[model samples]
Target: MLDEKLLSRALLDDDKENLMKRLLLVCVLGLTPLLISGCQSAYYSAMEKVGVHKRDILVDRVEDTRDAQDEAQEQFVNALEQFRSVVNFDGGDLEAAYNKLQKEYDRSEAAANEVREHIEKVEHVAQALFDEWEDELEQYTSQGLRRESARALADTKSRYKQLRASLTRAESRMQPVLSALLDNTLYLKHNLNARAIGSLKGEFAGIKADIDRLVIDMQRSIKESDQFIKAMQH
Candidate 1:
């Protein structure tokens, strides 16, 4: 009886070992692929949340901002044209017209400032991209990155000069005609002479010529800026 019991125990031990081995193999075969697939799915989902598709959602917002900027520029140009038609401030209605001019100046200043802020934001983001792009990968932001940067600076200067010129012109228009007017003035507000207007116009002509040169230089700088920015981003 003892011998019989020993043989039965040995057979039972063998069956247990085989069952465990089969269970382990089944687990490895079934679980390995599932584990890998789960990891892959999670990685893709995370990327989708923070990747290019997420960024593209802002495309409309960017477009809207650009559209608003264009409208502001149009309004500013119209206001400038209107200024050209004005008879100097001596028309005895000085207060109203002067106030209106001031308001337009404020409006233009606001719009220009908005554009500057937008550009600043773009620059800031471009800079941030360097962590990933410049070190390891390449990123695309603008073709004229270098140009935009240089132009941004130049545009800032140009806008400032234009604002200053506009302010001076506003003051000149308000000046009592007798204070600066001699004769042959193109603009007349009542008995005021027009010589001072011609003189002012000449000064502005020179300033405009300078502005044109600055603009050309800025344009050239923009291309170089684009290349530089691309290099840095990449």
Candidate 2:
């Protein structure tokens, strides 16, 4: 008799637990859509408060850097063309090649200056973005934003990181090319067609090859910067 009563009670308890779960689930299903709608509405309404205009400044800055890099690459190509004009590999025209290299050096220098200006502009925009993010975080935190605060902070951090990476790549790409152009020309004057120029290369073909590689790398870097800017705007 005791065993029968215990079994009946256990079955009743299981049924009650199952019923409660279904009711709870039904209640949640009914409320989920309202909760989701409210969240979306709140998100857009919140984003407007962190106002800083990215209308043209950010894209324009990246585009300017890209243009400068392209121009610098073209100038390098022209430098190679100027190099091709030299009469002979003999020690005779060494001075002439040196003078030609100097002109190319000056051209490359101007291009580097433009790249620097664009980079500075990028830095300025990034700093503004950083300030906006901090302001928003502080304002929201004080108001007990909780989950929204965490999400906003994560998004802000990601944006800052991506922009920083893009600029770092641009600088990395531009500096080496500039330095290589300068150093390569100097080495050319010393060893035009002989054995290794500073143990680096033996002929014009090698210089052309290295320069070609740099051109390709610079193109990739500029594209990355453009993508990064687009990401920030979105």
Candidate 3:
């Protein structure tokens, strides 16, 4: 009887193992289409499983982009200050000065890249949500409800367009600043001397101007992001 009980227990454990394997196989098969569709689709599908829809992802991405812009503003300002210090070099280690300026440039470039990536994420999930919203309007049996939803979608799209334009403007402004930083960094890299510092002084004005414009545009974009997030939440 003990042997028979042990045999039963063994069979039960085997059944459980088989069940788990089957469940895992089912899960993989279920996710195959989403994976094949693309990374964005797979990401959205995974989020949906956790009850976070594309709309939520879009809002989160916009917030991230806004924060990135804020950080980028700080980075550019810091880079400008570093450049100022380097150009005002009063007999210090030229190599150290160049290294410091290079580090600043790298930080500014990384911040800009982060902002761009965040914007792309926002756009990706937004397009998915908007497309889904448009398609689902057809499933509504009530004409009044369909019209209302369509109006909402249109209003959301309009607001999104404004936000996108603001972001684009801000993004474009970064290019000039980055170019100026790159030029200064490269110039200093090749000519690490007091005379090189004198030449870079002239470049400070242009970089400062670009950064000022970039900051203004980024602030506007951040404000738009806040408005859009509030609107979406409602």
Winning candidate number (lDDT): 3
lDDT for each residue of candidate 1 in 29-128, tens digit (9 for 90 to 100): 3357566334432322332332322122122223333444454445455444334433333445544544454555556556545544443333333333
Could you tell me how far off, in angstroms, the CA of residue 33 lies in candidate 3 after the best superposition? 18
Residue 121 displacement in candidate 1 (angstroms): 0.9
Residue 90 lDDT in candidate 1:
43
Error of 1 at 148 (Å): 26
Regions of candidate 1 where Cα sits further than 4 Å from its true position:
1-65, 87-92, 135-234
Range of the 10 consecutive residues with the lowest summed lDDT in candidate 2: 43-52
Better of 1 and 2 by lDDT: 2
How would you encode candidate 3's per-residue C-alpha lDDT over 105-133 as one tens digit per residue?
Answer: 99999999999978876887789999999
Q: Which sections of candidate 3 miss by over 4 Å?
A: 1-37
Counted clashes in each candidate structure: 9, 0, 0
Summed over model 3, clashes come to 0
Ranking by lDDT: 3, 2, 1
List clashing residue pairs in candidate 1. Answer: 145-225, 145-226, 146-225, 146-226, 147-222, 147-225, 147-226, 185-194, 185-195
Model 3: how far residue 174 lies from native, Å: 1.0
